[model samples]
Target: MITAVSELVKYYSSFVDAELLKAYLAGSRSEERDPMEHIEAGVQWICQAQDAFECGGVARSYSMIYQPYFRKSGWFAPYPETTGYIIPTLIDYARLVNSQELVDRALRMADWECRVQMPSGAVQGGMIDQASSPAIFNTGQVIFGWIRAFHETGEPAYLASAIKAGKFLVSQQDEDGAWRKSLSDFTMNSRMSSYTYNTRTAWGLMELARVTGDEEFEEAAIRNVEFALGQQLENGWFRSNCLNDPSQPLLHTIAYCIRGIMEIGALMKNQEYIARARRAADSVLARLRQDGSLAGRFNERWEPAVSWRCLTGEAQMAGIWGRLYQITGQPDYLKGLRRTNAALRKVQFLRTDQPGLYGGISGSEPIHGMYGRFEILNWAVKFFLDAQMLELSLMKKSDIRLQSNGLGDVASAN
Candidate 1:
């Protein structure tokens, strides 16, 4: 603690003005007063980030500019894990807006992923070229992209790669449905242990099964989901979940687990699994601040472990809530969707002049929290774009329902 304090005292002033730094250091929780809804602005921000990604070599994420701490500038290598799932978002948006550039960009990303696939069919953890070792989570994330590409263009290569990845994941799974090998070092616990959040792996595998008519993949995915469900506490909190820290699990991982379960439930037509996801979602909803942000970490009982907000988690959870609303037609889920998505828009830097700040979402609120401090994460923007897309899609569907009932205004339909 003393070393941490000394480091903070030494470099805090170098990063920001004293007042802002002081507020962060003091752990202030002041909310934005005049938050507004700006979906178009958000979409424009997404475009800017995409341009920046291309400037950064279309690998994955960029560091924006030089950091006083690292003293480096320009874009870094593309991240394999996030670059995988980002494909679907890019393709969907491209279709929605008729942007050929984005479609081309998504293709490039998908092609890059195919080039980097290991002989074992698993993508490595961390940034590009970090390691040759395969990681289960990273492989699943990339598989999601490969399958999406196959669906978009009927490219046999994309399908072949996805099939290879799915086979690797299935081979790695233990008889109990837990992945015992190929876990990433990103977790704080022992590297050999399995993860609750690999419910995402199950979801991705399910996608592979659906596209390829592979019953083995489907059965493997179901087993993995069954294993993940065993980790959920009666209170709906997931154990052994976090990218970096498990003692105080990040909302990001919690959201991952919840979304994966919810998706599996939807795909399998299992109301019981959906109810499990709703239980966890309600636990999170109870903790959301009036400003639509959540604490970055939480204890097993669903209490806040930190004052800072994980912006990525907020966006992911918003998407989950939107999905829930679609399934159940619940008004509260709609309210949560609007409030959380609006909060995200409030934080987006809409100025097109600065490519890095515009459309890029920070990893943490106040921009100096424990996770991804001072850096904009690629997955952050990907999930934010996803949440916004879901929100808009739901709103449009709601509008259509209202119109069919002879009500022009959303308010009247409510």
Candidate 2:
């Protein structure tokens, strides 16, 4: 009740200030509006975001949201966590179109992350300035980029960095496979001390295990995944998961858990694990509004906890659905994937005069909502690009305009 009251107080207080009120009104209009007509424009926005950060050389993240009040001369600062994982997207896009531009960009990002890595093989949480402390989660994400870089260019440095990070993860693991120390702010709240979404770290470890043929890494990854699996309720709810709040978990964290479980399941060929992931995913799919937007937060019962949608979560879920459909041959999953992707596409502001808003996905439909209020998040654009790319791989186009039957047959044909 206290949390609820505090949130309500925060919400109502937004109207008291003129700047906040103006921002909220503009966001409200953006939310109710239709999606842009072209997926190309959103793709352009994603490229712009990448370029926006590339000016700094390592192609890190933008430190500030490009807004009137928040505008600054130089905004590029490499966010180690997102930049680490963003390598795969850049590499994938580069390979798809044979674009050396993207390949060079990916190489620069990988090199930057490797250069900034802590001696202990960990990356810091938050932005470079704020995340001065070593964090296991951030390190795991960086390992992801490093591993991909190794595959793309066979760079010894990338592999070496990934090995260091993977070893660090193994060294930090508890007997029960849970990471008890070096946590990010996402899981350091007083209300919770651990998060199930660290399954993402486990997922990264699994990748390392595959490449290095290290049984220890595989065992550690599986141990952590087992820990996450134990948190799954019968109704498919995952406990102690969220970026900030545990009581009301964000769909973004939930998708992270689901995707991690699904990937590891595929790797280990564990049908039960795959089934469990699908069950949790189905619960989320059940809550999708007819318009394809999902509330950012959900309760244990899979009920909406917030009216605003988390654009990042929506994109992540689309990728999850796309992967599920590819694996399980589920028609509903493909349908939901397309619908959700379309809804996200609709929300992309192709005609925006504001460069910050041009191709960037809003953190929430109304920019003033709780998550990334009045800002365009780098990860939002990253996941949005991911989903679009996944959709393109499933079907032959960026737009989800293919027939349901044709799309459903993708896995079978492959």
Candidate 3:
């Protein structure tokens, strides 16, 4: 029978394997040819992910088929409205590349100041935006993205939207500091086998903490983490995952969840959250291999079915490993980082050289997400840059400094 959170390790192992980390440990899966190739490929992929989104901020998707046909593009381009997702991604890309165009795109999407605000004033757009009112989760995502853009570029356009979004989110929290289910529909569309609105709601709060230095955001984020912790299965796993995009639980979302908790742990200087992270890390590492590739999906029997690997599984895992290294100072995390990144390099799918053009991602892998396959490819650019720049930055900051100093000293002595 499944035991306590720690003992029910078998169920939780899927999260670890979600990123295909086995390949990292194997080490022979990918060649370390040109590092720039990976970076370039990542940039190309991100551009493609952006292209998938049509005008009016609609994702240009179909019915259950979920195929985002490029030929069907521009359908929504003329629409004056926008969605929540397109904005955050634009902001993230803006920060990573220091691109003004991305920042501009996000701001332009937010053109309607307070008019789009629901009674709660949160910014939201997604598949649901087409029908039901704005969702808290989607609003939070866009708000979080706009806040990042503000923090990165200091554009007031983004900040105005963020302030409304952040305050609205803070106000929406239940008395316990956690957000309730849905407010716009069915008092919050209560379909979750496990509570994720509160779990998923942490991003806007956490981002506010990072940008505003506000304790409320930090406190609110911890409350959601606490609520999510309460929802952990008997085997220490979370279910009732994303009903919106129901395929698999991504390591990135898991990482974000852990990060919210970790941030709270850091803010309060609490070790329990750190302990919690270590637990999750071990749970994930349990299924990881040296080659950096992880088993995509697992059966109820706890055996990994290799047929499930996808682009998202790797990028998200790479992020988690990097953060693990940050928290623990373990080189093993870096090895995981290198392996997963290499594997992603080998297969950067679903993107053309230039975005805003004819680009298509094959609608097969993870057939449930047919067109959205390239979504993860967009994330690879952001994470791959981290893998390269992490060590590169250190080398630049200290080693490069010392070498320059040494040369100056030698020249002076001569």
Candidate 4:
């Protein structure tokens, strides 16, 4: 009881920044702004994050609070895992805006990734300065950046790097397709051994297969995904899926799981994989609040595990829901997409004096929430841009009109 009180006191006492405190007190209320404006701000913030470190990779996050224990605050070191995925987002945005600068920035990031690749062809976990151990999930993520970079530049080096990373993943897998080794040290716990969320890693392998026409990579990806599907319950909840707690998985990891299955299903033309993904997506959709907020974590029975909102997860679900609508032509998925995106826009800081917070999405809705407490994460902004871009694309294609309130209604579109 004494320890709990002490911890709570420490948490509150850490709010030394008056400006950040004011922003926290304001909560995640929606503000009226243009989506493109938000996108541009987010892109600019990301560029700033990349420049924070001497390396060309994106910073892990920007800390809003000062911590004496870590003896450091502000933009963190370059993170290879997120920087790998951010490449595709930057490239997509660059094309949309016809900006060669963003394209060159993404290529520089890709080149840095290749230089840091471990001798075993795997990427390290955590920031560049952290322990240089090879991680399964991180390696899988870097493959995405390399693959996209290869397509963009037609550079043999990018494909070569991707192929090496894919081989390392295949070599580390057990006979049952689950990876019991090379887990990220940051997420390691004595109780958890296998992570079902590695399905995202499987998606990367499948992409390599498509590009290289290697049946070995495709077969390995299939085996791993099938293993993950076996862990799904009748209610669509996955066991052994969370980064730290499998009993109450974060919505961020949940979205990762669903997206991997959904994309792989579409690529392979498998109805079963698509159906499984739909079941999980529908379960999460049923839990969305009227204001478009979802609990940061959920239990196996589809119950909310926390009051705070995981904004990154919500942005990811927006994209997933949008894709589902595209696949099934379902109205509910479209409604979900609009509601979630609307909620995110409301919370995004447009006029903050802090460059780190401007147009950047917090890990949680409230600045001090548990997910990425007091920090603005780069991945959050990346997902937000992707979801908003998707929503705009679909609206344009279907001739949907945006309402005065910033959210468009499907009834009006028809």
TM-score head-to-head 3 vs 4, winner: 4
lDDT measured at residue 170 in model 2 versus the true structure, 0 to 100? 90
Cα-based lDDT at residue 127, candidate 4? 88
Give me the candidate number with maximum TM-score.
4
Instruction: Give lDDT tens digits, candidate 4, residues 1-414.
Output: 986676666655667666676676664333857778877888988998998887799999988775443445788889999999999888888877789999999999999999999999999999898888889989988899999899899999999999999999999999898998888677666367888888889999999999999998999899988999999999999998888888999999999898888878867889899899999999999999999989999999999999899999999998888877876778899899989988898888775667777778889877668898878899998888888877877776763323222222221110
lDDT of each: 0.73, 0.73, 0.48, 0.84
List, residue by residue over 330-382, the lDDT tens digit for candidate 2.
77888888789888876665445555556667778776578876566667877
| Model 2 worst lDDT run, 10 consecutive residues | 405-414
For candidate 4, the C-alpha RMSD (Å) to the true structure equals: 5.3
lDDT winner between 1 and 4, please give it: 4
Quote the positional error of residue 367 for candidate 2 in Å: 1.1
lDDT by residue for model 3 over 1-414, one digit each (tens)? 333453334334433531223223322123354654545454444444444553323333321211223212222221111234345544544555678876666565555333455556654333323444545565665664566456556778667766667777777777565565344443344454333434546755676677778778767777777776765544334443444332344444444455455545544567886666556555656667666666554332224544545445455556556555555667776667667666665543322322421121222234233324423322334444445444333323332221233221111110
Worst 10 residues of 4 by lDDT: 405-414
Q: How many residue pairs collide in each prediction? A: 2, 3, 27, 1
Quick one: best lDDT, which candidate? 4
**Which RMSD values do the candidates have, in order?**
5.8, 6.3, 11.8, 5.3
Off by over 4 Å in 3: 1-33, 48-119, 176-178, 183-190, 197-200, 233-236, 242-253, 297-306, 350-414
Rank the candidate models, highest TM-score first: 4, 1, 2, 3
